[model samples]
Target: MSQLELRGIRIQLRSQSSPLIELPELTIQQGEIVVLMGPSGSGKSSLLHWLVGDSLPEFDCSGEIRVGGVRVDALPTQARRIGLRMQQPWLFPHLTVRENLQCAQRGTETPAERARQLQACLDAFGIAHLSEQAPDVMSGGQAARVALARAILNQPAVMLLDEPFSSLDTATREEVRAWTFAQLARQGLPTLLVTHDIQDIPEHAQVIYV
Candidate 1:
């Protein structure tokens, strides 16, 4: 069954000007990837913001955001169980790569199990050696990888990506996109990817143009 669903979703930024988003309905099945594409200011980011319960106070939202069959619109952002990856990576500058990943681990019954999960994730992302490295010391691509590893370490029911590869060069972008999709598939988690770049859309992605 699909882990994420948006039904009759509509959002409007309370501008002195006009509405920001007009999405009607969107659904993502388990392990599926849905790509949202539009030009800048077309509300792509706004839609993602609403899905994860981060709709700005200046925005008015009327919709149902469901994750694993649970309505999450009324829930706090931390309770949504949705992992979000933005273009800037958003890793904590003060923490080492391992600490960032460790902080995101979820559902483990014991500290040893959580540590094992974190170590496995770092190994899978090919960043096991970076465990002790500070964010500022890593290259851009490496930092982005760490950010993604952290986001998935929580084993979210769904994942939301906002132009996550925009900072990478062409080759690196493709590599990371493939890595991300593969990881999501392995986790059996539905994903909503928001990006203006068409190349970022994977082969099986269902595209929504806003």
Candidate 2:
């Protein structure tokens, strides 16, 4: 329901260090993708952390992060309702794939409604068969898909993906990237993706080199 917004953003590793990434503003419209690329230590991930209200202890930032025109910089990580998927699946080692997705459905929807939504997410990600499987048993591509499904199940207002497809083989990476983009497009979620690989950039995306 909201696009991602960052205004007057400046991030410093230390108070005395120069800003790593400074931006007057950056916006990703609904259903659009923004590819954030930069050299090592240039703070691409730091920008995402800042936007999600979880700046690392080594960093200090000044910015106004808004979703749907409402400031969320002051909100707690969970309160912000921002979705994130990293290079690893990061699913609970103790839970099955279905449980992982169920745990992410923390919204106010009714139980019946939530179940329907969860099933749809599993089906959409093509992981219905893996629902009862443990996360450790899944292949790289399957784990990535599980992560994507969990993120989508959360129904985030905006999402930040940090090399979500990096861990896959070339062919698998391409397939998962296409599937992920398709799902994101279907939901019209404003997403910021960080990657060093140019192939990961979707068509007509806005790229920001930090």
Candidate 3:
């Protein structure tokens, strides 16, 4: 029943008086994906940073963010219970794929149950073979898949994606995008996706221009 709600969102450069992005309200229900599209410097990513509770030292942001009717804007990033996948993959270079994914474990599942889900996710993402490899050894596509697996494993209340499929080949990109949307829908995770490509938008997604 968790839904992401944002009200009175306004972001602006600290050095300027004009707002970079402003929206009166936005709501993303569980199992729903909302796409944010805009030009290169239109504050799409900045809005997501604000949602994820990231430090925006260069910009000033004002908004109310809530999940399931509870305020989360004042909470720390981790405390806000949101997962983010950026264009860079952001996997741990020092750890093996499996270990990196293990770092995302946050549920109370037993060891056996956890292992089962991990393998299932790896297989689902077509990355089971890369489980023992380091991030540096994987291709951009592989790394992206691994990064996505970790993000889902984290089981956040909301998922924020920042051009997550931009690195994949055409065919892989479509496949991964479809699978990702399906998985998120199945899990009932509210999602906000930022992308420049219209092809990235899923059917029925609420598209907002920044």
Q: Which candidate is the best by lDDT?
A: 3
Best of the two (1, 3) by TM-score: 1
How many pairs of residues collide in each model? 0, 0, 0
Give lDDT per model, in order. 0.84, 0.87, 0.89
Between candidates 1 and 2, the one scoring higher on lDDT is 2
Off-target runs (Cα >4 Å) in candidate 3 are: 107-117, 123-126
1-210: candidate 3 lDDT, tens digit per residue: 789999999999999989988989999998899999988888888888888899999999998999888899999987888889998898888999999998898768999998998888788777899999999988876787788789988878899999889888898898878877887777789999999999999999999997
Q: Write the per-residue lDDT of candidate 1 for residues 42-156, one digit (tens) a residue.
A: 7778778777777478777788888878898899987898888987988888999998887787654598888878888889989999999999988777888898889888767
lDDT value, residue 187 of candidate 2: 82
Ranking by lDDT: 3, 2, 1
Query: By TM-score, how accurate is candidate 3?
Result: 0.91
TM-score of 2: 0.95
Q: Any idea what lDDT model 3 has?
A: 0.89
- Candidate rank order under TM-score: 2, 1, 3
Q: Which of the numbered candidates is closest to the native, going by highest TM-score?
A: 2
